[model samples]
Target: MHIEVAKKSLQKNNQEVYNFLIDIKNFEILMPENIDKFEVLDANTFKFALSGMPEIILRLKEQHPYEKIVLGAASDKLPFTLTVNIIATSENESEVGLSFEGEFNAMMAMMIKSPITNFMETLSKNMDKIA
Candidate 1:
């Protein structure tokens, strides 16, 4: 499954947003208000549980300086990647977007499509918090 959230402009520059996202702990600020549990396991990993979702562990999979950050699920049972793309629009402003790609069977994909799409959109909307 692949899902892309709408991009949003941030008040901060691309480098600032990139720096904030590089630290896994900063993700807490971007999480929805319904988040029930959250913990930074290390510099590049975190565990979190939403109101009705199972606990998920995510680890940093790749980074491209101020351009992008990719995070992958820690377990193969639900393998997925969430990519954060940053584009500098000016000296002190930028736009950010979230894209999710997952490996799931057709039946499972149908079951998760809505919730996953909502989750990605929520995260993208929360991108402005980085400022």
Candidate 2:
């Protein structure tokens, strides 16, 4: 399944957003309020846990300068990819979009579709504040 979240216009330029995201620690600023634990393993890896969810680790898979950042779960158990794309709408502004890609069975997809969509929307909406 693939989900496209809302696109947000950021006050920061594409390079600013790219610089912030390339550093894993900055991700904490966009985390949910009920985080249980957070850890930065390195520049490219970080792990966090929500109130009742298991800790999930994410790693920077690939980054294309100021254009996009590709990330994926560090563990094979959680097979998913997240791509953050930045479009420079103007010299001082940028449009940000996030896409989540995962393979899920029918039952699982049905169960998670709504929540994941909401999460993605919230995440994209929140990025501007942190950028």
Candidate 3:
């Protein structure tokens, strides 16, 4: 399953957004308001529990400098990849997008598709407003 969330112009530079995201502390603003718990286990790993979803660990898979950030589920139980792409549009602004790539069984995909798509879209919109 592949989900394209949102793409929009961000107020900050590509490098600035990239740097802020590398630190999990800033991720709170990008998550849903009802998230039960979010903890940073390490510099590149964090675990979060959504209101009605199982807790999952997301780890930084790779960094493509100021262009992109790739994160994936640390547990094989829920295999998925979250990609953040940044393309500079001006000196202090950039076009940013969030996408999810996952492999899910037929029934599972049917269940999660809408909720996850909405979740990622919300995250992407909020991320654009970050300074």
TM-score of every prediction relative to native: 0.96, 0.92, 0.94
Task: Identify the superior model by lDDT, candidate 2 or candidate 3.
Answer: 3
Tell me the tens digit of each residue's lDDT in model 2 across 66-103.
99999899988758998999999999999999999988
TM-score of 1: 0.96
Candidate 1: count of backbone clashes, pairs at least 3 residues apart or interchain: 0
Model 1 lDDT on a 0 to 1 scale: 0.92
TM-score comparison, 1 vs 2, better candidate: 1
lDDT of 1 by residue, 12-75 (tens): 9999999999999989998888899999998899999999888989999999999999999999
**Models sorted by lDDT, best on top:** 1, 3, 2
Please, what is the whole-model Cα lDDT of each candidate in the order they appear? 0.92, 0.86, 0.88
CA error at residue 2 for candidate 2, angstroms = 0.7
Error of 3 at 3 (Å): 0.3
Q: Can you tell me which runs of candidate 3 are displaced by over 4 Å? A: none
Cα displacement (angstroms), candidate 3, residue 56, comes to 1.6
Candidate 3 residue 118 C-alpha distance from true site, Å: 1.4
Give the winner by lDDT.
1
lDDT of 1 at 32: 84
